[model samples]
Each structure stands twice: as structure tokens, then as C-alpha cells.
Target: MLKHDYKVRTGNNQYEGFLVDLIKEVANMLNFQYDIYLVHDGKFGSKKADGNWNGMIGELISGNATLALGLLSITSQREEAVDFTKPFMIRYITVLMKVTKSTTSYFEFLNPLHPFVWFCTIGALLFVIIVLYVLERIGNINRTDYPSISFKECFWFVFGSLLHGSTDASPSTLSGRILTASWWFFALILILSYTANLTAFLSVKTINTPIKTVTDLASQTRIKYGTVKSSGTSGFLKNTDIEHFAKMWAQMSEIEPSSMVDTSEVGFKKVKEGNYAFIWDTTVNKYKTIEDCDLMEIGPPFDPQGLGISVPTGATYTEEFSMAILKLNDTGRISEMERKWWVHRNCPDYSNPSTDKTSGLQIENVAGVFFILVGGVAIAAVLCLGDYIAKRILKSVKKEKVHAISPEGDDI
Candidate 1:
């Protein structure tokens, strides 16, 4: 339904225009047709092709296309020009500076209570509150639906579940039953898993690092913290402070004002040059480089947070995309994409990182069995409940029929 041009860097340094391929895939899935134009690779090209939104503004303003795709940083200023989707990738602006001083490490500054972690925590809490309030409202309106549960009760119910609660909401309504049995159960598990992982990330201590926090930058004896001039300098690397670098590397793959110098030899050239700090993203595997620079991540990796495709503000498309994304999450498409393009770069050697974390219980092995047991129990419950209601209705109907047919067969 729309014509668009797009480009991304290939494994080689050369730019590969793949607009047609993306169009084919998305169009087939969306059941629509569109014209795709091959745009220049933004990573290595003219200034216009750079990640900056200004250069591409001309195309959008001139009616060249309806939308532009790629790593277009969507900010409040640029948001006026074109709408952006939620971030498809999460990265942190980091300083690939040398560790000049041995005394100070970057780990001290990154605490668990940092704004990023708090934001996620608060967000989870708010979501729990909103869901509980909504459930409470529905429960209040219908007596047969969760009759005994109040808003406060439901709030604590979700709270306990998020922290560590047994699966007991005391919900009495069919709606509540269906909701918990379907959506909430899976949602809770995912949220908890990510939360746990994040907690572990924050707690990790770097064995040897001098600087700890952003404030300690001035005090950092020998290291110099810097980022790409385009992206914010201090703010990007502030959270990464030495300790969290590895965790950041594990979760993110792309970054703005990326330090990825060149795809050839994995940007090792810049690192080889001394005193020059390259602001690049950390990947799962280290690229062996012949460049003069050694790849030293100054601190923990931080979340740079970039533009993703989302519906316009106040548009239902946003919700639709979010719902679809959730479904994709259920199907593992989102994770698979990350593993393919971002993590492994489509390498077969790259295994599912999440699967490596499983301990006592393997979800894949037990999930089907668990579902079967649950399905049997649910079917049995439904049958028993249906039979009881059916018998009650049948008995009432028979009584009315008998009364109507009494004696002379006159209508009652």
C-alpha cells in the first residue's frame, strides 16, 4: 500500500540495498503490495545517508516515500518530521577508552537503583497497578465475575505474583478465570525472568576496574570517557560505568554514533590506533583485530535506546503493534530475530542465550506435558460445570412443562 526505500550494512563493508527483500516479507505477512526503493547504506555513505534524520527529511517531505526504515534515532525534535516505531534494538552509548588508571574502576557508579533499572521496576509496578485496577473495575460491575475480590486485594494478588506468590488470585468470575488461565500466567513468568536477569546484571562486580560512577569521571585517574559527538557524550556511558559492561554487551547489539568503525575485521582498525577512543557497541563475540587499539569496554554496557517502528502517538496502531509484538514474543519470533541478525549475525553457531540460563527445569521439555495436564483438568472442570448447569436448567424446564400439561392440557 506504500512505496519505501531502505538500506542496511552487509557483513562486508559494502552497503547492500535490501528494500525489496523487507518489502516482500512484510507485504506478504501484512497482505499488501508496495514499491520498494533501494536506498544507500547509511553506515558508510554520504552525509545524507548517515543515521541522522535531517538528511532523510528531504525524502519524506518531498513525498518520496511514506516511511523510512532503519536505525533512525527518533527524538522529540526529529519526531516532528516523521513518526517512529518503538525501539527494535536497545543499545548503550559507551566509551571504548583505555584503562589508564588501575585504582579507579567504572563499576562503582552503576548501582541497582539507577534510573534505568528504576524505570523498568516502576514501569512493571505501574502496569501491575493498572491491570489490577482494571480487573477490579470489571469485577465490581459484574457480581458473577470475581465477586469476592476487591481492587486492593487484586493489587496485592498481582504484587505477590510478581515478587513470589502462589497461583491463587481467589478470582470467582469466568472472565477472571479465563484471563489468568490464558494471559496473566505467561506474562508473569516473562516479566519475572527479565527482572531476575536484570537484577543479576546490576549485582555483578567487576574484578578489576578503577572508576565506579559517572561522578567519579573527574576522579578517574587515567581513563578518558568519550562518545561519538553526534550522540550525547556523558549520558550515554554514564550508566555503563566499568562494572556493567559485560551485561550490557550481552543484551545489546546496536548503538547510535556507533563505534563500529568498519565491518572489515569488525572495526578493529580504530581500536588499534592508540589514545583514540572508539564509541562502538559490544557484541557477543570479540572480533580479532590487527589494528593498534585494544578493545577495552570502559564500564558496564548501558541501554542507548533507539528508534523502533511504532504507530503514531494517540493512534490505535501503536496498541495493535504492541499486541502483535506480544504474540510474536509468544512465538519466539522476536528472540529469534535478535539471535539471527543481532546476536549471531545469522550464524549457526549462535545458540539461544536465554536457553543457556535454564537450571533445574527445562521449559521446552515440560511445557507440553504441563499444557496437556492443564488441558485435561480444564476440560474436566468445564464438563462438570456444564453438566451441573444443564441439569438445573433441564429440571426447571420439566417443572414448567408439567405445570402447563396439568389435567385438561390447558395452557397454564
Candidate 2:
């Protein structure tokens, strides 16, 4: 209908389409001859601000065409102007976008857990270290059997337990041991949860599209989105009372001519160039995606409608046409036509098979853990250096005091 060289037209000026085939079948059954031609404006029709119609709806109303075929969506507004047959195809408005390659993020390993979860984990680790230090100090006040645990050693023990690493420190008293056991169990559960989630997060190739739904497209500015101008999709957007659609229409109006395209083919080309999404009939979108593997449809239908033949208002043949279309549906001929047009394409399926299976965790998947480990080691090194310098200063002060008391630097 949009003048596709292969699907809609052949080199010899012959026409072909699922809707065309269905219309031919219906004509044969009804014993009527009809001529087919494209709408002069090449539009599905929309009520302009001046209250005039254009495209196929216009053609039908003005008696230029007996009936309009192609992907003419049934709508309440269009119904007011022209009569329509029972829908031959159920269609909905959906977003069409180019299938983008999955790119790696520097912090991709952190994706498994939310940032808040990571913050809480760090806070919990520090809290556990403080609790262990306090418990060990209290136990050491009465017991003389083992050396008292220092704050530094307590920190090291908790950090090592969380990482499932070896540590030099151990709890001597019963209270300290009990606390350590609880911390160890907690760490075990945390590790298991992180590992399981990381596996799934890494295996799935994340598609980072800002526009998943019509609402998403309306809400975002980074991705430019629109529909074919003077088409049913644009008409729906302009007329819808829904808040998001209303906002989107306003935005589209601000952009004017560029935001609205003349055809879905042009919209598809814009999508291929990136940062753009085309909102169009789901049936056409599906056919386009099948024909071009680089394209994909996003989200469920925004507006549920049906594709039907358009005829003049109160046309005498309306009942006969509707009944013929219903008969085609009853006999499964419509489904057969859909299979032939929509599914029987020669395009390659662009989905990656490796992405479907659970892949072994790569170093990048666990890179955050390694970064944390390196950071911990660095902090411990700094603390160790400070502690050594402080101890040395204290020892020097004591030696000087002894020397001053002994009246010389005499050995004890």
C-alpha cells in the first residue's frame, strides 16, 4: 500500500498484498468487479483542523473510489465519515525501532543489584565489624586466656568472611564466636543471592532502549519518536484524551513537519539511523520487522483497532462486504493469507542464540568484586602504615621519658 517495490508492486506494474488478495477473493465470492488504485494523498486519512478529510477516507467520501483497501484502520472518527466492512485484520499501534547491539558498560557487573542494595551492603559490613570489635573487647575484660582482638583485626576478620577469604584473626571468647558464626551465615546467604542474580544479569543481553512503550516515548526526549503524518496513528495521538498521548501530540506538533513522516518506510529509515522510533500499525510493523532483521517491535499495542475496507457512508454493499470478510475468517483463509505474507519471509532471524542460554560467568561479570577486593586491600595497607607510625612515635616518647628520668641514656 505504501508502494513497496517487492511486496506491493512487481517490476511489470502488477500489485500484490494480503489485503489485495483478500479483497480479490471476496470479490470473486460476491460476483462483483472492482478497480483498485492508491489514494492520491497516500494517507490513511485524518480530520484536519479545517474539518476536512484526506487520503482513502477522503477518496471514499468524495466518490472517487467505490471502496478503500489496504491497511485502513477502523476508528470512530473515520467511521463518522465513511462506512467500513467488518475488520479483516486486528491491528494495534506499536513502536518500531532498530535492533541495537548490546554494548558493555564499565559498571555492568553492578547491574545485578540496585545501587541502594550495594550501599546497604557496605553499611552492614561496617556495622558488623563494629559489633564484633565491641563484643570482643567486652569478653577480653574478664578473660585472660587469649589476646584481646584489636579493631583493625576485627575489621579484617569480617571483611575476609564476607569475601570467603582466609584471615589470621579468630574469635577467642564464646560471645565473639557466636557473633562471628551469625555473620558468617549472613555472608553465606548474601553471596548465594548475589551469585544467582549475577548469573541471570550477565546471561541476558540488555537492550538499552529508552522508549519501550508509548508512555515511555512520550516521557523521554533523548529518543525522538513519531508516526506517519495524516495517518490513523497520528490522528489517534492528536485526538486521544489520554494524558500521555495528548502530551506526545503536543510535542509532535512543536516539532511539526520533521516529527511526522509521509510514510512508514521513511520512518523506518529514520529508526535505522538511530535515536528514533516509529509508531505505526502493528501488522505493518510486524511485516517490516520480518523483512528487515535489523528492526524489531517494542511493547504491546498502545491502541487496539482493526483493519477494514473503507466504503462511502451508508454504502449499499457494506453488509455484503462485511459478510464476505467474515466468511473468509470462518474458513481460515485470512489466517492463511497472513502466514503467507507476514511469516513466509526470506529474511534472517537476527537473534543471538548464545544470549538465550545461561553462559558461564565472565571476568567482566564479577569485575566489581575484584575492584572491591583491591579497594579493601588498599585501605588496609594505609591503616597498617598509620598504625605502625603511631606505635613507633609512642615507643620513642617512652624511651625519651626513661632517659630524662635516669639522668642519661643508660640502658635498663
TM-score of each: 0.35, 0.59
**In candidate 2, where is summed lDDT lowest over 10 consecutive residues?**
349-358
lDDT (tens digit, per residue) of candidate 1 on 305-411: 56455233344445444445455556766666554433312221111212222224335323554676788999999999999999999999999889878498777
Tens digit of lDDT per residue, candidate 2, span 159-180?
A: 9999899688888888889988
Error of 2 at 76 (Å): 3.0
What is the lDDT for 229 in model 1? 30
Predicted structure with the largest lDDT when compared to the true one: 2
TM-score of 1: 0.35
By TM-score, how accurate is candidate 2?
0.59
Candidate 1 RMSD computed on C-alpha atoms after optimal superposition onto the true structure:
27.4
Local distance difference test values of all predictions, in order: 0.45, 0.81
Our tally of clashes for model 1 stands at 30
